[model samples]
Target: MGYGFAWHPVLLNSLLLLAAALLFNRLAGRRYPHSQPAAPAPTPSERVGVSRADLHAALAERGEVVDISEDDLEDILQRAEERSHQRRFGALRCADFMVSEVLSVSAAASSDKALALLRDHRFDALPVTSSDGRLLGEISLRELLAAAGMHPAPLVGQLMDTCPHTSRPDDPIERLIHPFADRGVAHSMVVDGEGRLLGLVAQGDLIAALFREQLERPA
Candidate 1:
């Protein structure tokens, strides 16, 4: 009887210990849950051996692409920007920026007179006009020199550029972009409706005007 009684107490003690262990395990599991497994690393083919289609797909992930390549799209954007600049320039008139105090020469002026006038004003070219102030042509230092080489006392009209580029006061400054900006035409004659000289628009003047306008723009 005594041995059976002692075995009962020991067995009861063992059962209590087992129960406490089970409760502790349940509490521990609730306190710190197991972490999720990490994502698998990309394979060699995905990492290094990407195909051309895959390259395009990656680039197009943030945008759509139709028939144009990336370079073609960039070119189209650049041309659009250029057109926008031209439009902005078109808003300004030629008379507003042309040099009003234009130094000109008579069509019958001598080379010595032309040279003196150019040296006095430090001008690249001078508009050659008729006595009635009509636009005749333009004479530059180059023309004067060429004429002087041919004759000792050369006339201004002989070597002048008869087909000089001319513009109207009301015309947009954008008109100069082609002649001055693209074709490298340095000087232009601003004439009135009656072909009378009003002013002169030179490349330097246009550039200065554009720079001033840019500086005065709102930040």
Candidate 2:
């Protein structure tokens, strides 16, 4: 009358319960699988496809925009495009566009000699360099004219702008744009690490380089 080996039934029931649980878990997983959220769309700043029409439509959708006219907006866009172009071509160094065969007057040269060089070259200014080709200053037509009535014409060193604007050959060409525009800098002497004259960059040169870049840019 003892419970004669009832372990078999208990083991069978345990196995059945485990199987049922596993089957139910598999079914539940099939019915409700894990999912990932969809990615967000690219914003205007992230995508290059945002056009002027898109901007106008966006402004219209907001309703009753004020102050800025369409022309002003177009001008702004043009400026932005120009800035983008600059950034894209920022790798262009001063040495790339500078005129290597520059006509510089020696600092020891007389005022008359400096003026002659400027007039002969049809240049507004000329860089004054030392005998060893180091940049000392710049001489302009105005300086010579200012000393016109002097009993003795001053030397180029005396009349030159000692603190003239200068740029390193490795510098980005874009760095000179502001100086050319704001300070009326006609030429920037491109020097080396030891301040030796390497080349010259005129406003026209910069403008031509940038214009050429624009023309060669892909449509």
Candidate 3:
């Protein structure tokens, strides 16, 4: 009877330990999933082995490709060919598209005075210059508005974009397109041989020229 009693306690203890171990294993697994092995890192050589079908699959996973029919493609190409024929490469000049008259403010002009000009003309930006028409800088409407609330006379020289990018009049139409396309500048100053302001080339000028080429195409 004593041996049987001792054996009963030992068996019960063994059962309790087994139950506790199972519970611990379940809890540990749920709490620390990251303790498992990490996913494999991609190899650089993988890209070299990537096929065109794989590339298509990856892009497709991101978004669906918009399909255009063969007929549509042909029509677009026909229109493009016609525009190429219509472009008057020799006749086009900088003076034809440039805005000759521009409202340029002196570098010494106060922010308040500049604000007044913008209010009257509804212009968002103005070019800053010296009295001699020497280009100094450019200021935007947003900068002017911010200064207006402060009631301060910020000098145009201090606020204007001094190192403004520019282009030459004698340059080809590609000059205008490249800047607008690459740098996101809305307008470019057409400078003379001596860096004098000859005219202004805007996004509109390029658009008009491109459209004119298309419209004047031989039917």
Best candidate per TM-score, number? 2
- Candidate lDDT scores, in order, read 0.75, 0.78, 0.68
Model 3 over residues 48-83: C-alpha lDDT tens digits?
333334555765796966476545654454455334
How well is each residue in 61-159 modelled by candidate 1, as lDDT tens digits?
968657767666544544554467666644667898898888889978888799889988888889998988998998888877666545568788776
122-143 per-residue lDDT for model 2 (tens digits): 8888888888999999888999
TM-score, candidate 3, is: 0.56
Q: What is the lDDT of residue 9 in candidate 3?
A: 85
Candidate 1 ranges with C-alpha deviation above 4 Å: 1-83, 86-90, 149-152
* Winning model by lDDT: 2
Full-model lDDT, candidate 3: 0.68
Off by over 4 Å in 2: 1-87
Q: Against the correct fold, how does model 1 do in TM-score?
A: 0.58
TM-scores of all predicted structures = 0.58, 0.60, 0.56
Question: Model 2 scores what on Cα lDDT?
Answer: 0.78
**Residue 21 lDDT in model 2?**
75
